[model samples]
Target: MTKITFVQQDGVRIDTEAENGSTVMETAIMNGVPGIVAECGGACTCATCHVYVDNDWTEKVGGPSMMEEDMLDFAFDVKEASRLSCQIKVKDEFDGLVVHVPGRQG
Candidate 1:
């Protein structure tokens, strides 16, 4: 299992263990982390699972695909590091990944 920390815009933090190969959004939702509604259930169709990857972890987390990129445009606070959590698969290398949730999530 890998540990993933989720920091909300309000500074609230949620640290949880994620199984390798699972999406970060799945881990967040399963652990009841606020700010990640995951209304579409990891489908990359909804922007509800939006999160900002910490700068230091960006290269490891990687960028979103064209479809995810297009969906992120509809997020509340889109940033260069913005990513749809559903599209991010957790790996052993992401053991200490840190992500920030936006203030608002639809």
Candidate 2:
């Protein structure tokens, strides 16, 4: 399992365990992370699951795909580290991954 940390908009931090191969959004939503609404489930159709990969972890987390990039266009406060959680698959290397949840989902 990958140990992922979610920093909420309010600055609250949550630590959750994610199964390898599961999407980040799934792990977040399943563990009840407050800021990830995930309105479109894991379809990459909605920007509700937008998160900012931690500066240190950004390169490893990588960027979104074309489809996910289009969806992220609808997210609020988009940043260089912005990513659709659903599009990010959890992996062993992702252990200790840190992400920040936006204040609102666009």
Which model scores highest in lDDT? Answer: 2
TM-score of each model, in listed order: 0.96, 0.97
Q: Deviation in angstroms for 70 in model 2?
A: 0.6
Q: lDDT tens string, model 2, 13-98?
A: 99999999999999999999987899989998889999999999988888889898999889999999999999999999999999
- Single out the weakest 10-residue window by summed lDDT for candidate 1: 69-78
Task: Judge candidate 1 against the unseen true structure and give its global Cα lDDT, from 0 to 1.
Answer: 0.92
Off by over 4 Å in 1: none
**Alpha-carbon error at 76 in model 2, in Å?**
0.6
Best by TM-score: 2
lDDT of 2 at 64: 82
Reference-based lDDT, residue 81, model 2: 97
TM-score of 1: 0.96
Q: Tens-digit lDDT track for model 1 on 1-106?
A: 8999999788888999999999999999899998899989988888999999999999988899999989987898699999999999999999999999998986
